[model samples]
Target: MDRIILHCDLNAFYASVECLYRPDVAHLPVAVGGDEQMRHGIVLAKNEKAKAFGIATGEPLWKAREKCPGLVILPPHSRRYLHFSQLARNIYQRYTNRIEPFGIDEAWLDITEKGMDMAAGRHVADDIRGAVQRELGVTVSVGVSFNKVFAKLGSDFKKPNGTTVIARPDVSRLVWPLPGERLLFVGRSAKNVLHKVGLFTIRDIAHASPRVLKGCLGKAGENLWRYANGLDDSPVAMVDETDPIKGLGNSITTARNLTRQEEIRFVFAHLAQSVSKRLRKQGLVGSTLQIYVRFSDLSHLEHQGQLPAPTQLEDDLTREAWRLFQGVRVQKPIRALGIRLTQLQSVEEAAQLSLLWNEKKRQQTAQLEQCLDQIHRRFGPESVRKAPGLDENLVSLVRSTGVASLPGRPHAF
Candidate 1:
């Protein structure tokens, strides 16, 4: 039997989720993003109504506003979106256990066994779409194919709640004439090179000499050569608990370059809260904490230090992050700030315990952290946020960025 993969993508996910609560905004030129004050930021998501006005994701929000002044700008509700995402995943589990969430808005499911025929696969996809629409009142697009890349492309064939199938024989007919940029893994720079080589379409690359393509792209060139020919064999592997996280960090590009110590401290506290929440969620502790500072000139400086112990405790992580920040010289306007925790170990499995502190103090600190985590989980992150994080400006900025919530819904671009 030919292997089958189904790529499911939620349409205009953030905007769709927003529409659930505010149906009045449906079919309007709505966008979800940060405040207009952040001049360089772009539309995070847009409804079909906004797309009709030539607005696109990642285009500056100011430009989008200009393109359609009446565009409804809604602050991204990360928590609510996440809640919807969980509902989508739960529905997916009913179909197959071989599921891999791509991000907040997309996932790949191996239903080759469950879906014995193309028609069955389509039925499964339709069922998923109906489930989302019924349970969450959002629409989804599904792409059914024999591999990950084609499955993803199939999902994009239609929009705002649609489905497309890519059988093996139709691969060339469906994909080859598409622009080189449409191929997976081809970024802006690669597209330029391909363009210059007169390889404007996937068909052009498919017919090009392997030696020439490899010479041009190195290892990536080889992969592209295979992709152009519809020869992808990558499997949809379920995300494993033990898989080392790609990265553990927090970063914020401020609305304006900040110089005040209080403002910087406030940002630091926010970052700390975010980082600690991630650590607890992953059930991991870190041994090294790194701080990154990007000056106005774009030059960057980094400071790192070994923590006394591998800790998931917010207070300990924050103290170390602040210590590193203090050591870095701030000679120029700061454009961005970041904090990272590395050298990870499962917190539940770690054998090492603090010995320097007296038993009572250690117990008290642990109890305090446990209480805080409970409050955060039960009410919300803000329900138990540190006082420093409550600064009005800081709260507005964080809420706008939508980073406070856990990864829930699969969002589509």
Candidate 2:
């Protein structure tokens, strides 16, 4: 039997969640964006009304404003969005455990294990969509198909509160006419490559010669051909079946370019704190520390170093990031800084204290950061920062732009 898959995508997630809590702007052309004065300014999400005015996600906030002068811009609330994402997932849990999250706002579910036929699957899709709308006050677009890739594309075929079912017999009629760019992983560069080779539509990719595709586009060429032909067989993994997280990192674009060590250290400390908090939450530690620096000229530098041991402590990350920053050779002022913790392993798998290092001091620092995490959870993220004499303006700019929220970027679901 063909697998039954459904892709659930929350519509305008951030903007919709904002409207649910703030009824005053629910009717207006609202968007969730960063503050322009802080250099984090960009449209994160927009309502349907905003979409009508050509405002799009990740566009410059000023451009969006110009398109619709009355566009109401709201600050992002990450915690709230996280809360709703979980709530929406709870609704999906009622149907199947074979749920694979694509991002914070999108997930793929396999209902094939339930032994449901196409008719039954569509009913389940409708019920799931209706339940989310009724309970969460947010609408979802559901795509019902027999495979994950097609299921995702089906969800995108409709919007806000619609369901699109691409059944076995309907693929040729419903999907082939769409451009090849509509398929997942076919970005701008891939599209240009496909078009250059005369694969302009999904139908073109479906009928293209495999020998020619492999030679021209490499593995991606064959992958797209298979996807276009509905040959995808990837499974929707259960929550626990998902792959272990590779890393935890956070970055921010400063309000002004930073060149001095003091300014860089202040930013690195905050970034390290953010990464550490997330690592603790996941009960993981990283042995490799990396930092990315983007200069004002848009050029970037990234550096990585091996740590003595795996750690989820902020001090370890901060020290390693600072050391890496010191080694970076860039003449330009840095407009942004990013810290990444890779080479992850379970906290239980961490190495024992080194004979060369002080064990008591390491334990003490870990305990302190854990306590601060608890305090931040209760009071707020801004409640207790470990870095002293940190520039308040810099701190606030990073804080307002939460770790999960990046300007001019779309959620890569």
Candidate 3:
């Protein structure tokens, strides 16, 4: 039996969610982004109207304005987006258990086990799109196909609220004519390389020799060849069998450059607490802490330190992250700071605490953070914060700059 897969992508997720809440700007060209005063002003997401004006995601907010002056900007509410993402997944649950999330706003569902054919898959896609629109006040573009690659391509073919299906034998006719960049994982650099070699279209990739593609781009080039040829057989990971998260991280672009240890400490406190909360929630601990610093000029640096033992305590994370930060020699003012914990192990897998660090204090801090987590879960994230995080200036910077990625947990809106 042939596989039936469907990829669903939320349309302008951030902008759409903003519109749902702010009806006044619902019809205008809207964007969801960071505060420019913080030097973090970038268009994270743009509405269809904004897209029509040639304003793309990741463009600086000032440039987006230059492109379209009337663009309505809304501050992102991370919590709300998380809520809606989960709600959308709940909707997907109605159709099949073989659902795999691509990101917060996209997922792939395999309905083949349900004994469905392409026609049935199309019906399921339409049903899901309608349900999402009616219930969540957002639309989804779905791609239905025999493989993951083509299904993802189909989803991107249409926009906002539409569905496209590509059958097994129809791939050459439907997908080949498109640009090579449209193929999954084909970024600008790869496209440029392919272009230099006269492989300008998907059809070019489909017809190219695997040896030449591999010789030029190595594994990546070879993988793209297979994807372009409709040979993707990667399975939709079962929810229960999904891989464990390798890291927990959070980064923010400060309103102003941080040059003082005190200023850096203030920011690290918030980031450490945030990362620790997620680690505790996931019942994991990390033995390595990494700090990423991006300068005002856009250049970046990273430093990593080993912990005496696996820990999820905010105090441990804050101390180690601060230590790592102190070790780095900054030649420029730092514009952003990131805290990441890798080399993760389940809390249950952790060994006894080493004598290098105070065991009693570790236990106490762990308990304290656990209690705070409960309070935050019951009330709101802002209900409890570390004492050092009380600086209003630092608080505003952290809030305005916004989070880079919230791995397992949905960040607070």
Task: Rank the candidate models, highest lDDT first.
Answer: 3, 2, 1
Local accuracy of candidate 1 as per-residue lDDT tens digits, 209-278: 8787887888888888888887888877764434456347777767777677676766667777778877
- Model 2 Cα RMSD, Å? 4.9
> lDDT score, residue 260, model 1?
73
Candidate 2 local lDDT, 113-159, one digit each (tens):
65677777789999999999999999999999999889999999789
lDDT score, candidate 3, position 40: 71
TM-scores, each model vs. reference: 0.70, 0.77, 0.77
Candidate 2 displacement at residue 232 in angstroms = 1.5
The number of residue pairs in model 2 that clash at the backbone is 0
How far residue 342's Cα lies from its native spot in candidate 1, in Å, is 5.9
lDDT of 3 by residue, 277-374 (tens): 88988898889888888887666777888998888888888899988877888889888888889889987767444432576777788888889889
Candidate 1 collision pairs: 85-409, 104-409, 104-410, 104-411, 105-410, 105-411, 106-410
Query: Which whole-number lDDT from 0 to 100 does residue 152 have in model 2?
Result: 90
Candidate number achieving the greatest lDDT relative to the actual structure: 3
Candidate no. 2 TM-score? 0.77
